[model samples]
Target chain A: MPRLSADQRHCVRLTLNGRAVEGEAEPRMLLTDFLRHVIGATGTHVGCEHGVCGACTIEIDGALARACLTLAVQADGTSVRTVEGLAPEPGRLSVLQAAFRRHHALQCGFCTPGILMSLDHYLRSHPLPTETDVREFLGGHLCRCTGYVPIIAAALDAAERLRNGETDA
Target chain B: MKPARFDYVRADSLAEVHDVLAAECGEAAVIAGGQSLVPLLSMRMARPKVVLDIMRIPELAGISLDGDTIRVGAAVRQAELLAWSQLKARQPLLALTLPWVGHAQTRARGTVCGSVALADPSAEIPLTLLALRGEVELSTKAGRRRVAAEDFFQGLMSTARADDELIEAIRFPCGRPGEGHAFREFARRHGDFAIVACAAVADGKGVRLAVGGVADRPVARTFAGLGGSMLGQALDAFAHELEAREDLHATAAYRRELVRQLGRQVIEEARRCRA
Candidate 1:
């Protein structure tokens, strides 16, 4: 029953990457901007604020969503996961991240964070994925660098490693 | 690009939504998935004075079978609807077209009714609905009414929904015992908007074909057991009747050609399975 007016900022609270965080944002603020500028978790990159590029992809309440397409106030009371949450520990690479490193999946790393979030969520639900499935899922993302072949290789390799019970590298 | 400033409201009940909507009149935009609306907002193409988030309303969030109709709630995400166990069995047309609605990432959050509300000329859902003879349930504070899919879409990116009305649900009829349905789309990328999309439904007596991305709105026509070159002629007439225009992705001639070629393929596929 609360109407958060556009001209004023309101306190928006949500769980971010396992930690409870709150930020003040106007009703027009995008989740991506709130995450980077207000909460200071810049791991989630923003590209094509209109949601074409998947650089702004993240998990909202365990569902894959484009941060650029979601409003900050709409995320209130929900739990969000970003690329910063992918690692098991500081300085430790998750299996998917390790595979990307091994395959040299990234060139400039501008799109790596969002790609990691997507592959991480996808491989969890579909533990055993075919090469074609990986390619189809990757269609959501646009990577100008590496031409996506290495990214596909890394995703498949990570799926194999995870299926074999390897947690980290 | 950043969106123009707008007020926000998280409504927990239909009454609250109706109140704000009725008060704001035409200046309020309802956000349910934000997949299509968000882009319009960021581009400043649609600058609503206030955005009412309707997903929080518990009543608007489910899919159920009411007799032969699958009533899909406004809050039901596209992925959730596709994952319904009874989907492919009951509504094969939707099961086939839902995957082509958007990418897995976008479908994970985009709602089925949101796509209907957006009413893109080339959207798979609208075309499929019209092909299936589905209906859209629109509601306001006073009451609700059902509009047949054919009447719901007025033109490109337009619908008959009033300013105070919210799309409560969409009713997709369950497939009949002996009917057959098929869908085909051509897009440069898998998730991009289609250059041309077709949906066909065939019965023992006749076949209904719906074409999108060619005109102001999706167009459906019925053909009665036309064979070979006759069917081709009907398709040619439909293609030319659409007055296909040249866009950056395709030429008018190319779209007309697709209509001729793809049109015949869907009609053939649908008729082939009609038992």
Candidate 2:
């Protein structure tokens, strides 16, 4: 079989953060690139192109997935939520984001977007999570700073606030 | 790094998959979860001419149980299996091993059949399947057939599947009454590939042991006389025979020790669960 030229591109259409979005991508264009470049949602950071680092984590059809490992074409017709989608509106932090800030959950801030997105999706189902549960959930992500203490605390605190029906500003 | 350009085709049916595989032959790579293949593609480790996306095939999705066997479709993601309460009750070994496959995010997209087909020596899913003596169904343009997990895995990143064959599903025998199962792996980080791992399934009469990350392929053994107390000594003796190789992460000797210790712990845990 002959190798395909790198110039080939496919039309990709997907729902981005509750909005219908369309983009053209090479078959090899990663979902992370499509989210950051074509869709212009730069909040989803890409740390490791490999799946090991969860900095490229996002939600596809409401399930958490690694955007780095998913092709943009694979996400055609799917709903995706990146870190940019976590906030209720632009310029205002969501409850999880506020909790992270209050608890000083970030230092380098490179891993924060993925961690926040992961916790944002996780806390919805696990509103009464324990420290172990938070740790287990955060295990997918790798953070170089903050030693994960603040992050775990932030996640637990956010879970509490969300449980109490706190509104995002 | 971004992957080199390739053509993408989504197969909507089993026939479409077979036809695509037949036409593309060795040039096409199937993309299910894209958990492993996508990484390889980005690293330029794999350069296929075309990538066949099998996620849209309705026939290749869903989980069903028949009397004593549970069938998990190729498109059924690991997260789906983890969330499947009935599967947890029926195949406790899978339930025990699913979380260790990767993280919640990877599992949310990774499929059981994809893991089995990849046949990664360090992956938990293949080791669990080997421990359970599961069967993988392969389909072609002609027909479909089943291969035992033991025979299906040939070597590192190799399997018995032909170029034209697509993995249809995998069938695992339902956990029997009094069957207790435990899975444990030692990795530097939670989601890192294991340095050594073990899965144990035991009843009062016999025990099945499968070890991964210590050799070219995951290995399984059955011992009729083994019990929780005897597992440590038995595994210690068995570890000496493993073809463990030294890698940057660990020495061969260290991996053997891991197999010995983790094997015993899993067996003991299974025994406790049974009791």
Candidate 3:
């Protein structure tokens, strides 16, 4: 009902990674910036601020979305999950992360966080993914290194591991 | 890449939205899903004094079957529509094209009406709307009106919609007997914007083919009772008439060739699927 002005910051509250967090952001501030600068959750990286690159992907209310394409003011009161939530606990990795490590899916690791977020969401709905399906799904992401071969291998291995109830790493 | 400063308003009701739009007139921009607008904003291509949010309004959500047509509300997300169990049975063309609209990540948040409202020449949603001859329900301070898809899309990123108007919902007709719908797009990447996208509706009378991404707007032509060679010549004429220009991604000759080849292939597929 009330319009939040541009000169002042508005209070935005949302649950992040199973915990409630609050921050103040301008209406023009992107959700990616708010997550990193305001919420201090740097695990969600920013690449190609116009949403072409998938480096800023995250789970918004259980749905995969581009953080660069969402306004922080719009994310208010929503539950969000970043790459930080992927690990089961401190110093531990999820099944997908372990598979990526074993297969060397990432190099330089600039685009790893967003890739991990997307693969994590996809593998849940599609427990059994063929090589073609994995390849097509990875079209949303761009990774200069690994040539996408090892990433595809890692994704399939992670899917099989999850199917076998392998949860911790 | 931050957007310029603007005041944000989240409306809870249609009356509130009307008030805000009536007061601001043409200086406000409506936000829904934000798949396209956000990118433009980040690039500083689109700037407005006020950004209005309509997703909170109860009147702007839900999907319902109204007799022979399926009505998708303005706030209905693309993923929700793609997941609808009755989609294939009701609007098979939409079912075939929704997956091509964007990636799973973007589709999870983008709205159906939002796609039509943006009127992207290379987008799947508007192309499907035109292919099926569907309509979008427009709302403004003056009242509600329905505009046919053909007239709704004017030119490159232009539409008949007014600055103060909002696309309330989009109506897609249900699939009928003896009719088959097929969609094909040739993009460099699966989820990228199309270089040439074609959708064909084949029925008893003739086949209506709609082509996108090669022109400033999606265009459709009906070829009735044409033989193989005649159809090929007609397709060639349509391709040449579009006058597709050269862009960094493709050449004019290459695009016309895709239109000629992909268009004929899609038409055949639609005819084969016709019951």
Candidate 4:
């Protein structure tokens, strides 16, 4: 096996949910692998490995991107917020996560983490996207178990809950 | 699957990139956002001996507007293009077609030049660039050359770009006072490659329609100064002129119909934009 080497392995140091995490990786290592294997943050799931599945979605500099499709070096010096980081206050799922649970948005729960993280970031800027917006926004994700009726409902429910000043936690 | 073992070089400058490409010759590959190239690498579909990482090159990432053209750097990510407020206001056609490129996540890493250089017939940038009359700036050890979008794409995943040349930037004429454009496509599912896509631009010069995904490369038809009856016939003639290739996505006949349907729809939408 030919050992691959980088002239300089870029050292990425960024805040992973208020905590500084640093690592040195080749420019080719996928951010998904860096998080799941290297950092042991398995909450960020990897589904299609390709960008087709949003299961590996994470927040980079407050914008959503598929972890599987992005190289770890690309996130250098940029803050990364994963599904684990979304609930940083701890002891509970975020409001969006709670709405998903209350609305029975997931089954088997394989894609839940990614959905939560993506929607969490999306809703932060959008705050209120219509039902059609939810459908179109969620088009990036694929769910085989529950179809998408419940998931869409969960997003709608969360949008309403967040809008109505019902509950932050 | 892990990509095959290969040497990696994170090029810090264009001079370094040129030297690396010259050194590795045919065995080198440049990566911008890795949205498209990374997948091919991981699948082992592209086994280049040297992967030239260009993401760190500060010279290659920005979106700017000159007097009348929008210049997008080679490394400018798709998200930047979509989010650009100037483009949104000046060119809604670009904004409309931007979403169809890929998912938000993929677009974050996908570069405008990468999409054009890859020149996937089904890719949105090439087709959109064709309709917008875009130009590509390519660089090599020899010098820099600009190629019009029509001349840039030769065939499926084929371009006039040289093996050792790097695409520097893509430029398209900005908004015209009375001109309007529209883009539409049909795919099996959202985020999937289009079965057929149409991008139409109309101005005082007349109507120009560009079609992609239904053919080996994007095909354009122009009806110089056509209107009313002449416009209708021109569209039919244009539809007849696009000789599409049949593939698993759709039969040749089916794709042809999509081209016609989408062409008509996009032309109508452009007319509305004009109004």
Candidate 5:
């Protein structure tokens, strides 16, 4: 067997936020680091490098996963969606984002991007989710600020708007 | 933290995995979901020379029903199994325990066989496998063999599987009629590992109880014609048999108490459902 140097980088090509992107990273580089550094999508926050914190959440091949725990090389040929893709246009908030603002869902805003991305995918499938459903879904995410009250309110409000066929606020 | 530098080999088939493992013998690690392995790698706990990526192996992915057994492939993600309606209908205990495995994000990438392969004492998958009397299929270049769940799990982070072999699938027997099953665990948070967990299945004939997180490996006890009141006493006696040890999260005595309490609750719940 042949051995590769620790600094040797591999080429990774994938679709990010609907556009085809290519970058170079070591086999050991985490997907979170690759996205923020190589792809310049810093919106995805990295909390615990382990799988515990939901701060590094992203959609890989239409499934939610922890970017921190996933290797960049393993994501080759996959489609990824980060928090940067949530809004329709620059400087404009999506309906869910606007609801977060209206409901004052975030305080420090570190966990906001991951939460928004998670709920963006979640609300699409669960348009008429109940309070318990919303709470249970929120269990995966951790919000140190605002006591999660406003976050739940914002998620519920966004679900209502999305159900009413409102994509943009 | 980033993982240590290692060669990455993407195995498109089982043969390729075996070839790589044979060549790199004792130096290569097979990665399916990378949920558990990646964490261990990042922490420098596992520093293999080569990582054989089995996620792309088409043969190692899928969920199928063969007769009375539900076959779950090694690459079948935890969330995928949770979404399979047939699995939920066939094995209600597994369905109840899957949600408690981890958060939605982790489950999206964590594999069922990977969890069983890791054999975490507190993991829901292993405990449920024990409770359901499942069987794990392990394959090497020589051949494939099936091991019962009870004999498969050795101890904390240990299994009967050889390092050169890969887990193919796990077969779970379908739930029988008139059987009532319940799974209950006490965890600090919704997704955290349980301090002590109980999985119980009761029928008119008898009851089977499996407990995890309070022992080195999941332990089971079968009772025939045991009444509800006697079930509690049996669990109390069984609690003393566990070699529960103190960890940062809990003490041995606390875990024993948990087993006794949760054991009775799950047994009663299963009995009520049976009735």
Candidate 6:
């Protein structure tokens, strides 16, 4: 592995999914890269790299952020959750992931991880966002396929399910 | 693409950021929220050798009121500022334009100072701030200084912020009881950068019009206590003064028309808001 040069390393310590983690990351290394490469969580995908597409989204300190644009050093002392650690049990999906599958929310699946991350944060904050609100909240994620009609439905369905005490995935 | 390698220094204090900038001279760029800077760096558009991260800086973070002025710390995120009730009432211009900012996810991390400092002509807060006659407080290791929003924006992606200084805060002058402001914009898609935007402030005497994204910088002109036919003539003259750039988003002519339309609409809305 090619280590970040001495000058690029910023000593940072943070908690990742209930575990204390400390490392030196390049100032240039994106938070997505830090999570995937250094911390060994590869579920976070990088899609537009710019903040426009939400493919690289992650939850940092309980807020969704574009991991591709966020510097690793910026996450120092912060708690982060990647899609890989979203659920503990093997052969099972989180409610959102299962919802996406159940409602056919994804087609190509390239944009699913980011959509999942953004919707996770959105549903947590707004357990029951109206259709218009859900449309606006998920506006950042750009899905090249599926036309977003089903994705919108899935989000609404997931919200309804969650509010009705359905957590099984 | 990833950003070029640079040493990141997290400043715990405003003085520390200023000192670091002073030491690095023009080599350092302040990162507050990193919404604008991150893209600029990744695209290699801006290559500052030293990264002075100021999001952690204590002094540049929050929204407060000071002597009838709504003072917003530079590092205060747009979402946080929009959530304030007093900011909503005292600065309705900001509140109305807040939702148009990049969706909830982007607003969560984008800073007010980052938006103003980036000075993107199409951005919402800068033009609204300019129309509202906002003031930017800049601090350097040498001392502190203030610049009116009109003078602060130099041109496209430019501001009066010196290399050795950090934008400390922005002050929106509290509107008098009868004064009113209205902002309107047209974009290809919701939350996308505005193709053309207009912000208007109306007082008893006259209305002031400011248009963004139609020009390289936010341009303003006063109606000079005029309305009816005279107001229409002033708007036409102001539309001609616009220097619009033709980009993939909109043609210069289209943007100029947008400026004219939005300017006219905002003036009408401001009048109604006043009434």
Candidate 2 chain B: worst-modelled 10 consecutive residues by lDDT: B223-232
- Looking at candidate 2 chain A, the ten consecutive residues that score lowest on lDDT are A1-10
**What does candidate 5's lDDT look like per residue over A1-169, in tens digits?**
2233346888899999999999998888899999999989899999878877688889999999889888898899999999988888999999999999999999999888878888888898888988888888888888899888999999999999888888773
Residue range B1-275, candidate 3, lDDT tens digits: 88998999999988888878888977888899999889888888888889999999898999999999999999999999999999999988999999998898899999999988888888999999899999989888789999999999998888988877888999988888998888899998899999889999999888999998988889998889677899999999999998685798899899999989998988888888995
What is each predicted model's overall lDDT from 0 to 1?
0.93, 0.88, 0.91, 0.82, 0.88, 0.84
- lDDT per residue as tens, model 6, B179-210: 77888889877898999988888989888888
Q: What is each candidate's fraction of native interface contacts (fnat)?
A: 0.88, 0.68, 0.91, 0.38, 0.60, 0.53
- Candidate 5 per-residue lDDT, tens place, B145-214, comes to 9999999999988999987788999998898889999989998878888999899989997878899998
Total backbone clashes of candidate 4, pairs 3 or more residues apart or in separate chains = 0
Candidate 1 per-residue lDDT, tens place, B205-274, comes to 7899999898878889999989988998899888988968688999989998998988888888988777
Backbone collisions counted per model:
0, 0, 0, 0, 0, 0
Candidate 6: deviation at residue A105, Å? Answer: 0.6
In DockQ terms, which candidate is top? Answer: 1
Model 4 agreement with the true structure over B1-275: per-residue lDDT tens digits: 66665677768889888887777877888888787887888898888888887877888989888778899998899988998978867777788899998877678778889999889998889988888888999898879999999999999899998878899899978878888889898998777899998988888777788898977889888767765677667767666677778877788888877876788888878877887
| Selected candidate, larger TM-score, 3 vs 4 | 3
User: lDDT score, residue B247, model 2?
Assistant: 93
RMSD in order of candidates: 1.0, 2.2, 1.1, 2.8, 1.7, 2.6
Candidate 1 docking band: high
Give the worst 10-residue stretch by lDDT in candidate 6 chain B.
Answer: B53-62
Q: Which pairs of residues collide in model 6?
A: none
Tens-digit per-residue lDDT, A43-71, candidate 3: 99998987778999999999999999999
- Chain A TM-score of model 2 comes to 0.94
> What is residue A107's positional error in candidate 1, in angstroms?
0.5
Off-target runs (Cα >4 Å) in candidate 2 are A1-6, B227-233
> i-RMS values of the candidates, in order?
0.7, 4.1, 0.8, 5.1, 2.9, 5.3
TM-score of chain B of each: 0.98, 0.96, 0.98, 0.95, 0.97, 0.97
The local distance difference test score of model 2 is 0.88
